[model samples]
Target: MTGYALRKGLTFCRVDGRFVFLDLPRDRYFCLSPIADQAFLDVIAGESPAWVAAALRDGLLRETADDTRPVACIPPAPPRGSLHDNNQIVSRTSVLGALTRRAASRVWLRARPLKAVLDRVQERKSSRAGVELSVAQISRLAASYRRAGMLVSAHDQCLATSLAVAWQLASLGATPHLILGVKLHPFQAHCWVQLGDVVVNDQLDAVRLFTPILVV
Candidate 1:
């Protein structure tokens, strides 16, 4: 009898036969109970389910126009079967440049709203036309960022490092996809950069462990 969409600011994804949601502002992922997941499935399947009221109470879905169709936000999947390159000779200049970008990413994340910062990423991804990077060049960019990430004092958090990598590649004319992935068993979230099927920021073996939920 009704239609719905993801709650404002939430991105919807389906991973491993389950519904997954990313709340960027809250910096968390939301998975549904089996009943709610089935309700959402039915809703998106274009059926009006009586059970949707239960999902509404849970706050992940909101009312939409009756005719609106809710669809999953499908991001390009990381090339899990491909190996991540780490062979480039990293230079001090590359390290410095990446660190500078990383600092900027950190500051922007702290000073500006997360949506505003992500808006910049979206802007770069959309507006920067005519920029093309070859496979080798992309690998070099990833290598530089990986080396720079190693030197940072912060423990192994991936957000800032991944953002810097995406920003650097974009500045160099490569519009990179900054991917947000999650896994459920132990519950983990990770971020990485990719161009098409080539995963630039992390190893495929490690990258395969998570399913991409959002890409920006």
Candidate 2:
């Protein structure tokens, strides 16, 4: 928390010398103008920049008691050398179970607000004392999910699928990160699950296309 920090439910990080913001409350992503970006940096640095007052008026920044949160902070993206893929044999029964679980997740997501859904996921993730899953185990889980994913009807099933996968692995005592990411230019949002650097429910190359804005 800086003297002036991002409002609650808002977070941002730097990418390619620009600040990318994720507005969780609105469920949207955006980039600050170069001037606003520099102003934010200055505000965090304890020297109010020219646009600080305007940013405050705009509700982008709020008064903070004591500074702690960094301007840009989040988990590292999957490493280039990380284990990206693995061979696995998924049983028909497993795929069916995955389909059923993912469907439930989709229904749950549809019934709740975006922030509420993400909040519930974070609550569960914090409650569970999950273990580190082995690469082979992760592979099996991912493969089964992928097989079931083929049957999913929606193109925007990434959030539901990743949420279900993260919840599933957490129940098994495996700690998996549910990552929410965004990409600019065309402006897209995506979600995926991973264990350390190993992607759990999506391809590394695919997820790498977006920069992680939140890690739950």
User: Mind giving the per-residue lDDT tens digits that candidate 1 earns over 1-216?
Assistant: 456877778887777788888887786678878887887888888887887676678676688867665777777844843324567887899878878887887887788776678778888767764688776777677777777767875345577777887777777777778888887777787877777787877778777787777778
User: Candidate 1: deviation at residue 33, Å?
Assistant: 2.6
Clashing pairs in 1: none
Q: Which stretches of candidate 2 lie over 4 Å from their true place?
A: 67-70, 80-85
What local distance difference test score does each model get?
Answer: 0.75, 0.77
> Compared to the true structure, candidate 1 yields what TM-score?
0.85
Model 1 scores what on Cα lDDT? 0.75
* Shift of residue 36 alpha carbon in model 1, Å: 1.7
lDDT per residue as tens, model 2, 60-112: 87777876434654776454533334558879998888888899898998788
| Clashes found in each candidate (C-alpha, N, C closer than 3 A) | 0, 4
